[model samples]
Target chain A: MSTYDPNVAPKVSNKPIIWSLFAAGGTVTALLTPVLVLLFALAVPLGILPAEMFSYARMESLLASPLIRLVVFGILFLSLWHTAHRMRITVHDFGLRSDGAAVFVFYGLAAIATIVLAVALI
Target chain B: MSTKTSILPVVGSHHRTLEVEVLRYDPDKDDKPYYQTYQVPCEEEWVILDVINYIKDNLDRTLSYRWSCHMAVCGSCGMMVNGEPTLTCASFVRDMPAKIRVEPLENFPVARDLIVDMDSFVEKLSSVKPYIIAADERTVEDGTFTQLPAQLADYMSYTHCINCLLCYAACPQVNLNEGFVGPAALALAHRYNLDSRDKGRSVREDVVASNAGIWECSFVGACSEVCPKHVDPAAAIQQIKIAATGDYFINFLMPWKKSKNTDEASSGGGK
Candidate 1:
């Protein structure tokens, strides 16, 4: 007798959705994180680019464009989601018994941060 | 055989004494595992398994382990060497320090000294149906099946799995989820799925798509690093995930067009 029944469908996994998000987040983070760090930590502090580039008035002017706001929001949201997903996996790798509570805690922070980012952008 | 002509203790051969710590346990005699040390005189070019053989042959008759085909072909020599999954036969004594620690492969129940129970691994392997399941059966009238070089290349690397269980020891997902079909089994399934002769991908979807299957893997890539044969099981698992994702959408968008187990040949066009 066959153990699997096609009709019953051994409970299809919803992992594809989460995995796609995680993958997209990873791609975005890997591409942009180092450049962002260099710009803020080294380039700005070293005065390689004028400090006025990141001045409050200049940043506000940049944020005025919906296109720039959307790009920045996408990077922040994806990076946070990537970190949350990676942290969950890392905790499990450390041999800690992860429960539903752990998932809630990790992803809840990302969700809250995303909502806050959205409000600020608006 | 003349003792003088034998390879054993050839004159003027260099030997260095190594202190080897081996993990030991007897189910009936001890409640917990313990390490036992033996000073072994090792040849300059001997591998770890050779050192273990020296211990068994000269130092202690009671020491237990499994090994065959002193080369890396047989996966039976897999054990923890210096807290890393390795085939003892591939670890040269010259590359190691004076002291060596050997233990059973981690995340598996130790059956005895250096040997872990493999029943669960065998079950997982079988669950994936590691053999080729052709859509149509060929009779005696049909001669030998031929395949293109490209088709052979499609799955040649995955065929190198010697069932060493090193990947299982290295995999964090395998350590966490008992039901997760470990790296080797999943890679083997992928290997068969890639084969032009096989037709059991739909049948295998049940286990590979389940929560206990590919979903459990978090893409740690540890399995590929520890594999002696460079099977790259992590890559195979990811490929399975991509295929499974495609299957999910295909099933959702066009349920009527979903191919049945027997109708697999009609769908596989490239073969």
Candidate 2:
């Protein structure tokens, strides 16, 4: 019969929206890396900063700090999610011909990355 | 003596068969739309439009649809094929299973069976001033005007639009808002404004300022996906948004300058 029913709603996918979030996260992460580098370049070199700033101890200590921890966690989480989203789209765009397997692999990687990052940070 | 050559049955007569269900509506007769199915013999290479044409020519002469340039260039045969906005000429019948559903383009008011009222699209096309407005109209007579290839590339892809309106069908924003100028027209506007020889910045002022223009597009990318011509109207609209934003500021700073340039150019025999 007629496929042109008014009630037939168009299907909307979450992939593009998720990818957009990933792009935004990637942009922020990119900006944050430079800002972090600049902050260290300007602030740490001065005698006013802690001498441990150059050592692994400083890195661990910064990771333990609440503000730095929060920022790092957010960046790691968003970037991993973004990577997963983009990887899925890349698979689709390349015509992998296995939607189920592609989804499984992408989400699996994302979940594993999220868990690893979260556990390490927390 | 003449030798009679016997012709064998047509090639691919037994490969596959498709049940095509087409939307039928006669404005002069039927107030409500309905569907009629026809069993069509098709080869692997036969497209959905071919089946429809066969049904029209054989099964029912009363049945109506639209198509031209079966190779897909004319863009006159866009419709919903199996719930997707597709160019009928390009959609192969073999791609579907046992059944195929064909209907008029979505998000447009159906005037009849497979025909939709295109007045709104035409009006929007006109609103964009889809034409070149040369900076020096008289310079053309003197053969002083020419555009570089790179400059032409800026809007070259946008000009390839065949007025398919598939972008409009795929755009949810257009479906939600009837007032929206949709993607095709905005893309056309972008094409003209990007022309190096064109000086129609003012012509597009209202369109860009309107709620229906580029502001309505949410960049769903569906429009580009369904476009058979690879027009990428969504990208054109996005680039136009950037241009509009820049023009908003530039015009504020030099309100008199643009008008003065236009006036001087016109007075100097350039339209």
Candidate 3:
């Protein structure tokens, strides 16, 4: 019996919506992550950068600018989404087949974090 | 047959006897497949296919496998040569370790020994509608479909998929997701979709743009790596993903401004 049916469709997936975010997030993470790591983790910790360069008031001052806030928001937003997607794939790679749960949990956290970040920015 | 003219780069100088462990299964008899080792006196120029051929001809008459056209063209001789999915014809025996292990291509049901059941593969292939879809059928009198060299180049590499299933064997997505439309089929779909003469891209999008189609592919790029013909199926899938994303936004934003070139294709396409 012929089992192949191209016309047969299951529930239409909204994966593209999420995948677009994932891809954009990946690009942002790849580009900005290393520089951010060097500045935050290496230079700041090593005292190569003056501690005040990354101190709370300096960060607040940077965030006070609308443009700076948006750029920082964009970075955090994309990076969070990217990390969530990577977590999903990593979970699957580790032989956990429960994609539904992973998506719900990881993307759920990402959504919450993004909302929190957005509200904090405002 | 010594010193035969060949297009393959000459590799391995001297001959040696190799221990080849070929996976064997007889569905009518055995419950599970098992390795049956053979001491193959492999020639320096011989590939893994030749080793298997020697085993079939001399060592074990019961050995079953599929292969034709020993020069990588037929694409039927794909197997796990030392745990790596490869075209046995292109992989020299000299390149394999002394203790070689050969098995059916991974992520497939074994029909026999090295011949995996291709029923699902065939079904998926048919689902994609591999041939060019021209709304206006061209007769012999109308002459051949003329394509620009650029248009040809757009999809020429993908046309090289002989359905060897090596990409499938290598792809983790294919193994994890059974519903995935897979690399080779999606690449072939892209081939037709890119063809200037083919107007069926909109129609094909029903299957190509589905979640199981391009979205299921995480762009592991293993498909591109294992491809004998240098077909970058991963890139093709990524290209489709970008198009599908655009389609998603376009459909939501300005639903009226829909055209095949600059705009809409259904994201409902799937496996």
Best by DockQ: 3
A1-122 per-residue lDDT for model 3 (tens digits)? 01224568532345777788889999988888799899989998998998888889888888899999898889899889988998998888777988889989999999999999999885
- In the range A1-122, model 1's lDDT, one tens digit per residue, is 01222234466576776676677799998988899899999999998988888899988999999999999999888888888878887787777775466679988999999999999985
Candidate whose lDDT is highest: 1
* All candidates: TM-score of chain A: 0.84, 0.67, 0.81
Q: How good is model 1 by TM-score?
A: 0.84
TM-score top scorer: 3
Give per-residue CA lDDT, model 1, range B128-226, as digits (tens).
788878777988898766787777888899999999999999987877776677799899988988887888887887777777778788889999999
Residue-level lDDT of model 3, residues B1-271, one tens digit each, is 5686976755654488999888999999999999888898877788889889989899899989899999989999999887789999999876778999999999999999999987777777777788877756789999877766766776688799899999999999878876787898888988877766766665666677766677777778999999999889999889878876776676668767544433223212211
Candidate 3, residue A3: how far the Cα is off, in Å? 12
RMSD of each: 5.4, 12.7, 5.1
Clashing pairs in 3: B206-B269, B210-B269
Error of 3 at B85 (Å): 0.8
lDDT tens string, model 2, B117-145?
Answer: 88888988887788877665565459766
Task: Rate residue B236 of model 1 by lDDT.
Answer: 94
Residue pairs with backbone atoms closer than 3 Å in model 2 (clashes): none
Candidate with more favorable, higher TM-score: 1 or 2: 1
lDDT of 2 at A104: 89
